[model samples]
Target: MSSIIVTNIAPTITEQQISEFFSFCGKISTISLDHNTAAADKSLVAKITFAKKEAAETALLLHDTKLGPTSVVVEADPTAPAPAATADDAADGELRQEDKPRSAIMAEILSYGYALSDKATQKSVEFDQKNGVSTKFHSFLKDVDDKLKVRERASATDEKYNVTGHLHDTKSTLSRYFEKALDNSTGSKIRAFYADSSKHANDVHKEARRLADMRTGKSPADTPEPELASSAPVSV
Candidate 1:
């Protein structure tokens, strides 16, 4: 199925940032940009639709890089109906909210919109560029260095732990697997790999879950799957 998303873009990023990032990944169908001028500061919100899910996923990961803050990729939830407006709301009788200060605008431009993030998932995408997950994973690798320092301090011989080795191995394996998954001529294999990997264990499972959450702006728990029914007719 094709994927569509509406992003609450970071203010600092421009339309070029979004286009360039997706162009690097693959072909795109459309990008609709809406600018809000009534506010004190200018902001751009865009809806991006991709012909392929892989392209969307790849493009979404770019959110944390140069395109971060002003760029986010939100999944279009088909099941949830639009909130209904009451009669008073439709008549514009609701109280007007206070405006945000310039400081708030600057902060929003700099921040990666983690507050809008899903707390349960703990994944965040950048707004300026298309390469945030790799950057985030690299940042996470710093923890391994801390672990190694702790291990060396505890050891009498000052021997570092295998944290770095493990990280390198994990990164290498994931790179190879990801290339294989995307090597299909017609994109079918890539989708199949994504589907099958969801149900089983492999090195990519944990990282895929992490990246998926970061890219999609949705929690890992929200991933869709075909639920097994309890009552089923079994015919011989």
Candidate 2:
């Protein structure tokens, strides 16, 4: 098989984000993202066709792995017509890892896009920079920033206080404009992101502090004001 089927996809999952996760395995020929993912109670699917059979085998390796916080099923594409369901097969039913101990409702898909993420996954996925639909966080933020102008406002606010304040790292800058992109951000997603101190953990932590330092690092206000020269002659 040169293709794989991913099921139980959160509607929020985009084609690009999924590609980022799997592209490291091999060259992908095509990725078909579900357009009707918004339908409730329906689990979406994504079909990935890789250039070679080896890629499909490697992708099937993630069959039981977590996609974000939830477990999704990945399997090699059977490529044949659906089999007629027997009583036993129907009784068994399709089981997904996320279905176990299922919650009262499906959890909100907050896996946020994969771009600008300090995660090691970014080191692998190649993204198209031209499209607003680009998987890179910059593109993601750029689209969001258009209406809210959050980055514009944040940049203005920063310059208003300290004219020279700037973050050289573009990704971190975009992260700042997005405002919620820092390490101190708390939530279930962030907590999982910080799981067990690994190299990725250290990298995110260190990068967060680095981004924080842009403002907290130095202050124009800290410099002493130059003494004012009086136009009036000094008293003899």
Candidate 3:
């Protein structure tokens, strides 16, 4: 009951800014941002859980007003696990309508388009351990456009984000691990992970490059995805 949802946030807004903005409500237990990459605007949404119930109440008071730069809508999280709910409440089917369940990568994608934090890097490893991650990344790339195309016209596009930089950095990090040992030959799980991760990296980078071209008036064909500082050929 101490959670609230903040919507229509800018992608560039950081967790620190979100925390500071909501500090008036008291200690915050967690802050998570959600992004819709397929959305033309690519605005972010955040779910914050306050340590104290009253704190969330205090923040919800500012709902509908632009109390912070990134937040446009602040509302109660009716779906938060209630401390105690009567069996009658359950029988009545009093619940939030979850039109879409969140995916494991929901919190991960927003980490890109910016510098890689330790948390983001760690999350990458966590994703590797989770099942169906490669498929999810593939789907993400498809939404991003498999060819890594940037469909957003220059006029309709907002300010350019350094998506290429982040992807490049992430791939470089992956390459190092992929090349960590010469013994990691074909059929190695690590090798497969690297191959899949690198492919997605390339997919994301292609879109980033195209977006860059659109913004700078460069011909899409004239530019290539930025080369990673370190890269390795995958056997898998």
lDDT of 2 by residue, 76-106 (tens): 7788233233232112322212111101000
Local distance difference test scores for all models: 0.35, 0.40, 0.42
Clashes of each: 21, 1, 0
Tens digits of lDDT, candidate 3, 1-236: 37998887777877787776565444577998889565578878789987656456555544543433443677899889753331321133221111001111211222223222233233334434443333433433333332223333342233222233322223332222223211223214323433343334333333333333433444333445455321121111
lDDT of 3 at 87: 30
Q: What lDDT score goes with residue 121 in model 1?
A: 19
Better of 2 and 3 by lDDT: 3
Q: Tell how far residue 219 is off in model 3, in angstroms.
A: 60
| Residue 212 CA displacement from its true place in model 3, Å | 42
Please give the lDDT score at residue 11 for candidate 2: 66
Which residue runs does candidate 1 get wrong by more than 4 Å? 1-3, 37-40, 57-73, 77-236
Q: For candidate 1, write residues 1-236 as lDDT tens digits.
A: 23444455667777776665444333456777787565455666566665544444544433433345443545553543343432321123211110111111112222222222221112222221122223333333344334434553334223211222111224333332333323324223323432222222221223333333323343223433323221111111
Which 10 successive residues of model 3 have the least lDDT summed? 95-104
Candidates by lDDT, descending order: 3, 2, 1
